[model samples]
Target: MNYAKDPADYPLAAKDPALFVHQHEGAVSWGAVFAGGVGAAAFALILLTLGTGLGLTSISPWSTGASNAKALGFAAVVWVCVTSILTSGLGGYLAGRLRRRWLAVDADEIHFRDTAHGFLSWAVATLFTAAILTSVVSGVVRTGAQTAATTAAASGSVTMEAMQRGNPAAGMNTWPLGYFVDSLFRMPAGSPPPATAATTGSNETPRAETARIFLNSAATGDPLSPEDTAYLSQLVAQRTGLAPDAAQARVTTTYTRLLQKISAMNTAAKSAADEARKITIGVSLWLFISLLMGAFSASLMATYGGRVRQL
Candidate 1:
C-alpha cells in the first residue's frame, strides 16, 4: 500500500540495485546553494558600488560637460546587464563546482540538478539584494516625509497669510488663484502701481474675498455669478481708481483668461503623467531583460562548471 516501503513499485529501482542503495540521499545540495547565493550577493554589491562611482565620475555638475539624463540612463541599463551576467555566472559556477556529485544518477538527471542549483542560487541572490534595497528606500522615504512635515508645520501660518494677501513673492506655484487675483489689480499703461505694503495692509480682507471668489469659480468650472461679478467690479474700481464700466470689462476679461490658464495647466499635467507612465514601463521592461540575462548566464555557467567537474 505504501509506495516508498515497497521497492517493487519503483520499476527503475527494482532493475538497478545500485540506485536503490543510494536512493535515500537527497538530490539538492543546500549548503552549496546557500554559499553560492551569499557570494553572489556580496559580489553584486561590490560591482554596484564600483559602477556608481564610475558613473558619478562620468557626470559633471556644470551643464557644458555633463552627460545628459538619457545618456546616463542608457549607461546604467548596460551596466546592470553586465553586473547581472558576471555575478550570476560566478554564483552558478560555485554552486555546480561545490555540489555533491552523484554516483548512480543518470546523466540527464545530473544535468537537471545542476541547472536547478544554478537557478536557485540566482533566485536567492536576487531576493537578498531586493530586500536590502527595499529597506534602504523605505528609510529614505520616511526621513523625507518627516522633514517635509516639520517644514510645513513651521511655515503653515506664514504661507496661509501670503496666499490670502496674494503676495506675488510667496512661491507662485503654491497659490492657485494668485495670477487671477493679481490680474484684477493691474493698472492701465503709464499709471503708477499701488504700493505693495500699503495695499496689503489696507485691503487685506477684500484681497482674501476676491481670491475666494476666483477659487470657487475655478473649482466649479463656472463663470462668476452676476451678483459676484458686480460686487468684484465695484471693489476693483474702488481699489484701482478705474471707472465702473472699465472695471467690469476687466473682470470679464480676467475671468476668461483664468479659465484658459486652468485648461492649459490640466493639459500639461496629463502630459507629464503620461510621460512618467511611459518611463516607468520602459524601466520595468529593462529590469525584466536584465533578470533574464542573469538566469541564462547562471544556467550556462553551471553546465560548464558541471562538465569541468567530470574532467
Candidate 2:
C-alpha cells in the first residue's frame, strides 16, 4: 500500500454514528449563522419599507388617480421575490464566508455543510422577519381600533341626534333599519298633516314596535306573519291618514321591498367574503413561491461563498 494515499479512501467502521461519535462534533459555526440571519432580517425590513413607500406613491384614493389593483398586486408579488432573493443571498454569503474552514473533511461533506449553514441562516432570517412583521401589524390594528372606538365614543350623542333628526321613526334603531322603518309611515303628497294622535309622543310606541318587527324578520329570514301584517297595516293607516285598503297595499309593498333589500345585502356579503378568500389564497401561494426562491438563492450563494473562502 502506498503511504501517501488518502485515508478517506479506506472506509472506516468509525463512520457509523450508532457505534461512536465523530471527532468533528463542533463543525457548525452558530455564531456566523446568527449574524447572517440578523443581517438578512434587517435588510428585508428596509426593502419592505421601500416597497411600501413605492406602493403608496403609485396609487391614490380617487378613482381616476388610482393604479389598477391587479397591476399593483402583480407588482407586489414581483417585489417580494426580488426582496427575498437579495436578502437571502446576502445572508447566505455572510454565513458561508464567516464560518471557520473545516480541515480534513471531504469536498462533498464541506459542500453539504456549507449548504446547510446557508439554509439555516435563511430559516432564522425568515423567523425573525415574521416575528417583526407580526408585531408591527398587531400594533397597527390595535392602535387603529382604539382610535376608532375613542372617536365613536366622543361623538356618540351628537351622531345619535343627527340620525334621529333624519329619521324621526328611528328612535334607538340603527340608521339603515331606521331608514326603512321611516318609509312605512310616509304620507301621500298633499295629504293633511298627520293627526295629533300621530304626534311624536303617540308615535314612539308604534315606531319601536315596527322597528322590532323588522329586526326579527331580518334575523329569522322570515316574512311578517299574517297577524303582524294586519297589525302593522292598521298602525300605518291610523298614522298616515290613508284609506285602509291603501295602507294595506303599502304594507305589502314595504314588506316585499324589505325582504328584497335583505336578500340583496346577503348576496353582497357572500360575494365580498368570496372575494376576500380568493385574495388570501393568491397571497399565500405567492408568498410560498417567494420563500422557495429565497431558499434556492441562499443555498446557491452559499456554495459560491464557500468556494471563495476556501480559495
Candidate 3:
C-alpha cells in the first residue's frame, strides 16, 4: 500500500515490450546484468581451470587413492555446486544492485523486477560458462588422445598401436577385441585360423564347429567344463595331426591361456570403466540438482539485494 497511489503518476507503455529503456525509470537494466553475467562467467572459468589442474595432478591409476572413483565423483559435484553458487550469487546480486531504480513503480513490482533481472543474469552467466567449459574440455580430450597415440607410436608397444586404430577389432574370436588378444593366441601372422580351416563362406566346417563349441563353452568366466573339454579335445585331434591325449593337452593349454587373459582384462576394465560410468551418472544427477538450486539461489539472492538497494 505504500506505493499504491503512485501507480497512475508514471508514463504509460506505448509499445508491447519497452524498447527504449529509461535509465532511471525501471527496476531491470539489461546492460548491468550483461556486464555482471560476463564477469561471473570469467570468474567461474578461472576457478574451474585451477580446480582441473589440481584434480588431474592428484589422481593416478597406479596409486591407491586413485581407485576411489566414487569419492572423486562426489568431490567433483560438491566443487561444482560451490563454484556455481559463488559465481551466480555474486552476478545476481550485482545485477539487482546495478539495475535502474524504479522511482514511480510499486515497491512490490520493483522487487519482482529486480529478482527477475538477477535470474536472467544467472541464466546468461551459466550459458557463458558452459560455452567456455565445453570448448576447453573438447580441446583437452582431443589433445590427450593425440598425445597418447603419439607416445604409443614412439614406444612401439602393441597396446598403443591398437589404441591408435580408429576402430578397434572385436573381442576373443568372432571379432578382434584388442591387440592383446593376438598375444593371447600367439598364432603365426600368416597362419590360417586353427578353427577356420577348409571353410566356405556360408557353410561351416568341422574346425569351425569346434571353434563354436569352444567359444560357447568359454562363455562363462570359469574354466571349460569336463564334457566340453573332452569334446574340444576330440575336435582338435581330428583337425590337427596330434594324438588324442596330445590334442587334449593342447586344448587344456589354450583354454588356460584364454582364461588368464580374460581374468586380467576383466579386472582392469571393470576397474577403469565401471567407476567412470558411475561417476557419469552421479555427475549428471548433481548437475540437475545444481541447475534447480541455481534458479532458487538467484531468485533469493536478487530479492535480498533489491531490498538492500531500496533501503
Candidate 4:
C-alpha cells in the first residue's frame, strides 16, 4: 500500500527502474507569452487612440485654439508613460497567472521564470506596436506623395497653357529664378515705361531678377551693392514713370522693409528650432524612464500573479 516506504516489495516498481526518474518539460511557455503580448498591444493602441482624440479636441484651426506646442508635447509624453505602465502591468500579470505550473521546481527557478515571462511579454508587445505604427505611417506617406505628384503635374500643365496664351506672369510668381532674367533687360531711367502688353513685352524677366537679388542678399547676409542699388533705382524710375529722386527713395525704403522681414523670419526660425530640440530631448528622457518603470512594474506584478495563481 505504501509504495514509497516499500518499493522493494512492490512488484511494478521493482520491474520498472525508469518510473522513478523525473522529467522536466520546457521552461518557456510561448502560449502565455503571446497571449499577454497581444493583450498589452491592444490595450496600448486603444489608450493611444483615445489620447489622440483628446489632444485633437484641445487644438483648433482658429486663432483661439490652444496652440502651445511645448505643452502638448509634454502631455503626450506623460500619457505615453502612463499607458505603458498600465498595459505592461496587466500583460505581465496575465502571463504569470495563465502559465502552466511547473512540478518539482525550486522556488528560485519559479521566480526567475515568472520574471522572464513578464519581460518577454513586454518585448513582444513593444515590437508589435512599433511594427503596426511603422506600417501605418508608411502608408500615409505614400498616399500623400502620390497626391502631391498628381497635383503638381496638373498645375504644371495649366501653367504651360497660360504661358502659351501669352500670360508669362502666370507661373512667375512661384519661380525663384525669374528675378535674374528681369535684370538682364533693364530699361534706362529716361525711357518711357511699358504700360500694357503691347508696349511692355513681359515684366516677368525684371521681377525674376529682383527676386534673385533679394534671395542672394538673404543667403549671404549682405546688402545690395551701391551700383546695384543705383541700377535698380533707374529701372524703377523707368517702369513706374517716377522722378529719379523719388525712385531712389522708393528703392531704399523697399530694401529696408525687406531686410526687416528677413530678420524677423530668421529669428522665428531659430526660436522654433530651439523649442523643437528641447521637446525632443525631454520626450526621449521621459520615454527611457517610462520604459524602465514599465519593466519593473511588469516583473513585480508577474511574481505577485504567480503567487496568487499557486494559491
Candidate 3: tens digits of C-alpha lDDT, residues 1-311: 34433323344423412422342454458986897688778878877777767667657777676465545656677778877787778878877777765544567887788779778988999898889779988999999999998975575444422322322221222232332233323433465565554543322344344444445544564667889878877765655556788777777877676556656766887887987897678778889888777766776777777778767
Which residue ranges in model 4 land beyond 4 Å of their true spot? 1-23, 60-71, 142-200
Candidate whose TM-score is highest: 2
Error of 1 at 276 (Å): 1.4
The C-alpha stretches of model 1 lying farther than 4 A from their native spots are 1-24, 58-67, 152-173, 187-199
- What TM-score, computed on C-alpha atoms, does each candidate reach? 0.80, 0.81, 0.61, 0.73
The C-alpha RMSD in Å for every predicted model, in order, reads: 5.1, 6.7, 9.3, 7.8
lDDT of 4 by residue, 162-205 (tens): 33233334434433223323433445457765567765546655
Candidate 2: clashing pairs of residues: none
Off by over 4 Å in 3: 1-27, 53-63, 66-70, 154-248, 263-274
Candidate 1 lDDT over residue span 1-311, tens digit each:
54374555556678876666665688888887888788888999999999888777766676553356666778889999999999999998888888876655678988888898889889888999899978988999999999988987676433433443444334233545666777787777777867778567677667667767766666657888999999999999988888999999999888888778767777887898998999899899999999999988887777778767756
* CA deviation > 4 Å runs, candidate 2: 1-25, 60-67, 147-172, 192-198
Q: What lDDT does candidate 1 reach at residue 287?
A: 91
Query: Which 10-residue window of candidate 3 scores lowest in summed lDDT?
Result: 166-175
Q: How close is candidate 1 to the true structure, as a TM-score?
A: 0.80
**lDDT of predicted model 2:** 0.78
The number of residue pairs in model 2 that clash at the backbone is: 0
Candidate 1: lDDT of 45? 93
Candidate 1 vs candidate 3: which has greater lDDT? Answer: 1
Structural RMSD, model 2? 6.7
